[model samples]
Target: MQTFVTEAVDWPDTAPALRERVRALVAEHGERDQVRRANSWTKPDPQFSRKLGKAGLLGMTWPKEYGGHERSQLERYVAIEELLAAGAPVGAHWIADRQSGPLLLRLGNEELKRRWVPAIARGEAFACIGLSEPGSGSDLASVRTAARRDGDGWVLDGQKVWTTGAHVSHFMIALVRTEAGSERQKGLSQLVVPMDTPGVTVKPIVDLTGAHEFNEVFFDQVRLPGSALLGTEGEGWKQATAELSLERSGPERYLSSMVLFLELVRHASVHRNPELDMLVGRLAAEAWTLRLMSASVAAKLARGEDPALEATMVKDLGNSYEQAIPQLVQAAVDFGSPDNEVLRAVCFYLLQVSPSFSLRGGTREIVKGIIARGLGLR
Candidate 1:
């Protein structure tokens, strides 16, 4: 029997101060040319990322030893909350700060940590996940990327797709099959791969948003040192699963369309119709509830608890909200000549890309299955 409770945790009193600092940072960047973005966090902007890193907002939860601020986890969440709300261009440091750097801290060896963690904390370097493959989507255990040992090093051969920010990332925390003749989860291993390595090719994929954010990467006879392994060989499945938990539960999952949502709310305040008011209120309530659930999960992550089930649940609900925003707004707003051009444009952009919302973190079906397993209904 299992019982899951997302008890409301009182946010630290210092959150107000932290929120103000991040708000100021977001406002500063929002005014710059080539930076006023609608969905800022998903788009990579090295300049903005460096600024955020300089502000000590990149690795708030990491230790000072790793070039971090050694701040509390809730503080990290508060900072991230503000980033996503403002649609700050955090894509460059998003993966590294969210899971890659934390993964290294938990499982990477001393050299690996020393080699990458500091730069990541500084936002000078960027990282991306290499779990999804051409044939494998959410079925991470089915990854076919092979990292065969070759004397003191290893050789890699395979392909990964739908890898966000791969083209701009310096490194990839790739999960591969390390054991010959092994199937499924048994032989998986997490490896630190340099994008400049020979035989590695990156092909950009244009999403519906007409952006080159997602990528398809190929590893043909790639060679790597044995030290590239993040943790014990054949334990990658365990490590990768843990990392997915972090990915599934984050502010991004819910805030993907928040910029548009807020836009609509502002529009409503200025020019309200009864129908638009009702729609905005309903969406606001949904977003608020999802925020509470997400915050609870963040607290659990801080306590070092594996909340995969809880995270899956949050991702599903949050993703639905994100996916629903554009459609709802489209139906509610008069698109002929919107009263707010900025708001209407953001709403249009979100509407075009929101269909992929449920597909990004994990498909809705996959999350429901995980939730079912958590309740012993599988």
Candidate 2:
């Protein structure tokens, strides 16, 4: 693959101070029990989100004129790493804070930015991405959702599967075909549709872990005003391509499985086996590498460059590490009894959830295809 690492911007001098501030905030509200009690992998507590907003932690990259702190992306990244590492309930504001807000800032009309950016930064508004449809894993061009231009708006009709936070989000950044598909990436457009729009419905999808995180959202001739469209018509494919890089590379990629890693490492240290120690060392090294790769992407993004291929590499490798945690840990940690409820429960939870790490955001096959295309090997 064409290595897409832009010249690394010097780590912002402000990064350490911001990291310390975020770390302090985490220390104040951080609790393992609270994290365990959080129900959905995709939904976050509204109260927690408000608290984050009050702490001036949201909208780290937007301009100050828009109620943002105007911090560099690297600083924003450090804040996210601290939040995810501490297992904070950031799900409610995650999509809005990370992808939707930044996207709107880029392509939204002035009215849209003025109306939504402050609310998003304040955590009073939340958003979700409505990109995937049934059997359309990363094949965004194949989406069947159709939105026909009406007199002053558009009528949308389609279903989106595995839509995280769809049930509770105030808005969804939806992709739909605005024209016939012959143009390939053309003829596609993105719209910011309110979840409360008439004819919209969200149904929960329970996973093996009994988590109600993903959902199937249906739009039945939903009427949206012209203002709801995000960017110029037929520009969604380009917009979404850039946005996926934001999704694919980040602290969330590796930190989701960190609690499990800590548990496994603790078990190994107590048992003190050479094999387990070696494996832990290797995993830690990989984790550090992912951090460096992610940091490089953050630096590039800060410089107004999109390092899409580099971000995909981080996601691909980072997610593999996430999935491997349960298997490798399972092999290393042998409970005295296979039927031991404590050990069995942890094992079952990790195994059931590991599959989701690779599936969400983008699948392994889809990521590899992107990498291949970058290399001109396809």
Question: Top TM-score: which candidate number?
Answer: 1
At residue 358, what lDDT does model 1 achieve? Answer: 86
- Per-residue lDDT tens digits of candidate 1, residues 1-378? 435585877798999999999989888774332223555667888988888889899888888999889888899999998888887778888999999999999889898999899899888899988989988987878899899999999999999999999999999999999998899999999999999999999999998767888899999999999899998899999888877899897888888888788778888898868998899889989988899999999999889898888899889988888888888888888878746677777777877777888888778888888898788895
Per-prediction RMSD in angstroms? 1.8, 2.6
TM-score of 1: 0.96
Local accuracy of candidate 2 as per-residue lDDT tens digits, 83-151: 776667788889999899999999999878998899898888999898899957677788888899899
Model 1 misplacement above 4 A: 1-4, 31-36, 338-340
- Model 2: pairs clashing at backbone N, Cα or C within 3 Å: 44-92
How far residue 161's Cα lies from its native spot in candidate 1, in Å, is 1.1
Computed on alpha carbons, the lDDT of every model, listed in order, comes to 0.86, 0.80
